[model samples]
Target: MTQMRFGQGTNRITGTVVMDRRTKCLVKRIQPGQIAVIDHPDLDEVAAEELVENRVRAVINAASSISGVYPARGAAYLIRSGIPVVDRAGADIFCRLQEGDRIWLDHDRVGKVGESQAVVRGERLSAQTVWEKIHQTQSHFNQTVVAFMENTLHYAVSEKRWFMRPLAVPGMYTQLKGKQVVVVVRGTGYKEDLAAIYHFIKAERPVLIGVDGGADALLQCGWKPDVIVGDMDSVSDEALCSGAELVVHAYPNGDAPGLERVEKLGLAAHILPGMGTSEDVALLLADQEGAERIIAVGTHSHIIDFLEKGRNGMASTLLTRIKVGGKLVDVSGIRHFYPPKTERRRKAPLWAAVFSAPMAVAALPGSFTIDDSWLRMVWLSLRLWYFP
Candidate 1:
């Protein structure tokens, strides 16, 4: 492994190097001030948000951070967060440096400290460059959209089996017959929507099915998922042990990577082979389980959402929606639709007191000595209520 020494008086950023070709896995081992070495090409905003939340000091990408195939906003997110990203850092670094090695990144050079030569030097991404590239890509956005639509249509036809036939869903311990099921995915505005329908969740007591990391999202909002399904990469071990009935999504070939992890942890998980994203499988699971109503929270329903994820084809998602179309309800802006139950219940008592105030005063004699100011406040409230 080659090392590089910076000249005195020059500011050198130093941290422990943690490398993972998979950005999601790297996030688990990254510390607040550590340097993340990732090989994610066209890094997406979701991965960037996770890296930022972990507070990594800097990022070194073995692949192009923004490949210009799409406007992946991850590099821009890191730049905006004041975290430096060195893109196209040669793949040699993976062989040159091991995890937990002390490294220094100075300008365009990166390697171990106190050595003369750098292991891998690469271009440092700037906010300006990333912004320019994004705009450049957007200039040809119509072409990308056209390609995406073409892919979607092609896949839709190829994966029509999901809609044509009954889905083979795995059995679960959680009962779903005649019940409302809320399938949660960690998509856009998921947290907000969850908060909005919190009252419905409490009152209706829907069966909660979380897709991978969505399980953690449920836990974060103080709700326990009745079932958790996905590839199991993004979810934490803590969530895996939360006693939710685990369902591992398998490929058509019956390969389930998540099932191994579950078994290693001494937990049993049912493997279901289906063609679609984990979220899609989750909705299908609810429908197949005879759920009376299937409510989806934070799912991808828009063209832009698929585009943002750099997905060319949404065949599985489209087919899944078609399969469960009658039962599925995509939730958005739920906060506007319903207020929290506590707020509504609290207002009921206040309104009752306001309406009964005059009767109470009438029942009491002049000797009761009601304050004039209190009467005026009551009159104002009644006027506002009746007039408004």
Candidate 2:
């Protein structure tokens, strides 16, 4: 095993190095006090949140954390979380350092312990620098918007069927006809929004759909998805075995890579080939199932959400919105509107039970009848117990 060195300075951290070119994949392998080596450029907020949750000792980036193309609040999140981040450390670090190799990440350099030569040297990211970069990038954000719009229109023209016609979605066991369906995606503020709508979910009993890793998110919240739909790359084996109806989102050519993963796990899944993204397919599936209303949590709707996913074109999502318009409500809107409906519906049953209880007692035989004062007392007791 490789040995690590611990120094006295606050700016130095020594730990085992875990390297992956994919930020999300690396996050799964990393542990607390381990050094994460990743090649993610323009790291988004979701990735940063995972890194912070894992409590990695430090992050060494082969690519620039923020390319100034967009706000890319990931680096800012890391810095704010007090996790040291070394940016633009060069791709050579991957070739030079092996996984599980112990290394020392100093304020300015990273290298194997007891070595005088540094393997990767890069600038440490500070909150001030991140804030400044974001401010500078925001001023030029119009260019990004223009480019995104162009790409969206270009792809929208090619993929207009998704918006124009009804999707041929596979039959699902979960009945959604005239029922509320909540489609969950692993996007910004998903956790917060899910938590905020917890009462609504319990009260309304909506069909829950998870898109890829969104299944894991739902599981984390003590809820099992009624349907899990996506590429199946990010979801865990346990989630695959979760008994939810699996719907693999395939390419336009009917190539379903996620199906193999499901089969390997000895699980059956329905293949749904579509033109748009997995989330788009999810919404279309709900609509096809005759869902009365679709509540979306953590689904990206904004241009920045698409750009952060490195998607310049949101043709699929744009078309999906057009197709599901007036039926889909975002989490924010749900939080505002759903509670009243939930409360109203919840109270109706309680009120019915309350009124029916007295009627039920009154329907008893005359021999079982009690004084008016006793009956009033019983009603009062029932009211307190049921309403409280």
Candidate 3:
């Protein structure tokens, strides 16, 4: 670490800057000790987690990390992780600087090397300030919920027809009748959730449906998708060619945004024209196609999640859940339901163990009764002798 002469009581961070308007895309290229310049407002938790993982020197955001629209956890997460954040730095800073430009950021002042004046300025966010904002956001939760409900009701009246009016369920090359389906979405807590259900996936061999980039998540877990469904965005080319049946999501008007991408790869995809999120679409596909049960991984189901997604409402998710009914199961908190695997021991009754051994005398059936603890001790001694 380099120590520069600062005007006392301020730390100066010296590093090359990596700028991107999209934080999610920016995280893929950012490395440790380099500053990140992002334009994402109300940054989501997933983006924040990635930034914390990258060990960035500092974050200079063009937009407000917390807009107070809802209780966003991004700025707080980064701040709590001990990464300094400069919030609301004007967008013009991007025009003044280029990627890989070595710069110094001290408190709210940011500038190039040897520059007499600071090139751009912003408010350095503190844990206390953001937490106070978060508290206020929570206090006004009812207002946000009411607004979200009104928005949802408005859209629900228009979208209910699409969800309830019989969506055309296309024939899948992979049969779903009476079979279990696992719909994987690369949302928050997805990795931990996926790890929790690994045994179920291995044992049941349920059909895997990856929604967009979730296909990449499945591949990372060493499992290939049986059917990949989304608007063809966010999913990588490698996952597209992983032999999974492609199902492209199109708008209700039949405009397929991802069709050209699929065509370019010479891949034939089944068009599932529907109105809803890709996660909702995947759920409906599994249900309408006769999947016995649909296990959802990383699907957004919480109010906080909808807020982070910048959604005023989730009419699609709500309607889809109503239609799909109770067969949908989420993998969140599954670790509590299905605990981690541990070692097991095999043992029989002491009478059985003794009789099995040659030249071993067993007590008469009526003479003595062997207790569980005694049987366990005998088994442990024998196991130690053999296993050792």
lDDT of 3 at 223: 94
- Taking all chains together, each candidate's TM-score versus the true structure is 0.80, 0.84, 0.81
Relative to the true structure, how large is the alpha-carbon lDDT of every model?
0.81, 0.84, 0.82
Q: Rank all candidate structures by their TM-score, best first, as comma-separated numbers.
A: 2, 3, 1
lDDT of 1 by residue, 1-388 (tens): 1122222255368889999988878987798888999988888777788898888888999988777677778899888887888889978889999999999888778979777578889988788888998888778778877888899999899879655666566666789999999998877667778877765675578999999988987988889999999999888898899999999999877899889899999999999887878998889888887999999998987666686565787888888887788889999557666555566556665577656876867886576564676665666555433332
Off by over 4 Å in 2: 1-9, 332-388
lDDT of 3 by residue, 188-235 (tens): 877667877776687679999999878878998889999999998778
Better of 1 and 2 by lDDT: 2
Best by TM-score: 2
Q: Which stretches of candidate 1 lie above 4 Å from their native place?
A: 1-11, 189-196, 302-310, 332-388
Could you tell me how far off, in angstroms, the CA of residue 341 lies in candidate 3 after the best superposition? 6.2
